[model samples]
Target: MTVTAAAHDGGIPAPAPGTAPQQVTMSGAINRALRDAMTADTDVVVFGEDVGTLGGVFRVTDGIARDFGPDRCFDTPLAEAGIVGFAVGMAMAGFRPVIEMQFDAFAFPAFEQIASHVAKMRNRTQGRVNLPIVIRIPFAGGIGGVEHHCDSSEAYYAHTPGLKVVTPATVEDAYTLLREAINDPDPVIFMEPKRLYWSKGSLPEDASPDAQIASSFGRAAVRREGIDVTLVAYGPSVDVAMQAASAAMGSGWSVEVVDLRTLVPFDDQTVVASVRKTGRCVVVHEAQGFAGVGAEIAARVQERAFHSLHAPVLRVAGLDIPYPPPKLEHLHLPGVERVLDAIARLQWDDQADALHLPESSPACDSPASDSKGGAA
Candidate 1:
């Protein structure tokens, strides 16, 4: 497969006000990455529903069109299939076209194109063409919009062969992953957690030039280190996992959070290492617990870390039912309580310190009913 990556000028990376990393929101980092990629490569084009004028439903594309011009970054008809179908042709013609799915569920209309053409064109053509396309999807529950807006449908894409599925759980990864996805020789489903779009983090000013989690087409990140349990997650669940870990700390339990940045390549190495060290694992996600991404992770851990595991790998995930309305979402989506509950069930070596949770903990709810948009 033939491919080319964007070149960044060599310079000292900067952090925040002090020696700390620069504070950035996930959405802001993605916008920055888009601008950087488009600036570095004229062949890069971005377009989707309301992505140009409305700056996207979340304003992630706010100033892109204005700064890059209509031709480079513009809006498109309210047609998901046409958008992706056209991109397939563009990529074959040697143009890098980045697409915004607006919402996770909204991408359904283009499923045929994605699963059939966009995904297989590279191998189907016997390496004659490379679909270096990045399909950006803002997914998962918490935004509290209507149905078809909060679905964690990553499995559908991840299940499809020839397609690379990835989700970034941190601000820095959001930036770096998108840039990497756009440069990939194959089609990439870049799923961004809509709930975490406003989540805050920092970009270290001193960042590596050659370092990113794309060398293996995927990489799991260790958000926190602990010896007791490994809490594995991706996308919005990363935030929930971190919250659970923080809460577990108060209960005298040490918890490690593993962010599976790229789901398709399945970063088994990092996750297995963490599970082996902790001897316990709990996979979390907004997707249904049955046959969801968590199931695959739990199974893999069981096979690879069988000797090291002290308890069966548990999973904290959404109910198998369809995405619920905004009011009932809390009862369905995976949350800090669910994660902690799963951890509590794990058989631990030291039962000395019980998980006596505080009577009241902070609520980790997403902007539910009040959130705008209808695609999950």
Candidate 2:
């Protein structure tokens, strides 16, 4: 993601309802969310490597230490496991601790603490101990980061039954979802797309944070509406899917973009409804396609809307390999061209022929494939 503005209003509170829309960067939105959460609840404390004094590696916590003091927003050692373990202890002791992992891969060392204690404490103790902890990890590739800096590690967290995994694509969601996650009673894995830290967008001054954390989990947001195909994505890939949807129009295709804002409580209703209407679906992400969130989504769509599908559910994802060097990442990450090519392979003619549908069928009617159209 490219930075539209170099600076962020890190300590500004969310605009009151009915206020004018304000331009906000994703990182700035997150910072404001932290400040607001701390102000609202004395129990909320944030700690991570360099999060206090240095204001975080990305400055998402820029003014937090000054606004809330070192007790509320403080720093910790480089021990990832220790940080998370300390958060677990804080949560158990009646505090809403929002701890940061600093980077995507850095969270790996704390998986034992996260998966075993943080995730299961509430259940293991028969609801007597509810760990309202938020493990924030800066994730995904795109910013030309080195080996440990970039990794789409949501799959590991999403696979855990006790954890709620979510990644915000837009600035509004970056603020709203973080606030909601802080208020939730269970543990949440908040994956921040590092690449999108500087991406800017506007939030209605009066708009309330809508990403529900406790009562209803979280719902998917449809970024774009279309009838030809549905492009499903989350986190950093949502922007890519939106871009693909825009480019698909050149080929006379109407594409819908579904942002699965919350992955753990996976919004099947929104995704299935879009797929049913469009009759074709493509799951996009920077994570490996094999056994990734895409595979799970494809399976669910096929199970729920199998008969409605005109073509097989497809995936536009990162290759099933280690994160590549910064120079070679472009080839590894899914781009608009790759997504368009996948869209082209929806078996238009085959679908039309297999169903023996009329020439008016969407598969046969697509203008991009009309040159080879209706060849039965």
Best by TM-score: 2
Q: Count clashes in each candidate, considering only residues at least 3 apart in sequence or on different chains.
A: 10, 2
TM-score of predicted model 1?
Answer: 0.85
- Tell me which residue pairs clash in candidate 2: 17-206, 18-206
Error of 1 at 365 (Å): 41
Specify the poorest-scoring 10-residue window by lDDT in model 1: 367-376
Where does candidate 2 stray beyond 4 Å? 1-10, 13-19, 207-216, 351-376
Report lDDT per candidate: 0.81, 0.85
Write out the backbone clash pairs for model 1.
13-205, 14-205, 15-205, 16-21, 16-22, 144-368, 148-376, 149-375, 149-376, 150-376
RMSD of each: 9.8, 6.6
How do the predictions measure up, each by TM-score? 0.85, 0.89
Writing each residue's lDDT as its tens digit, candidate 2 over 72-163 gives 88999999999988998899889999999999999999999988998999889999999999999999999998778999999899999899
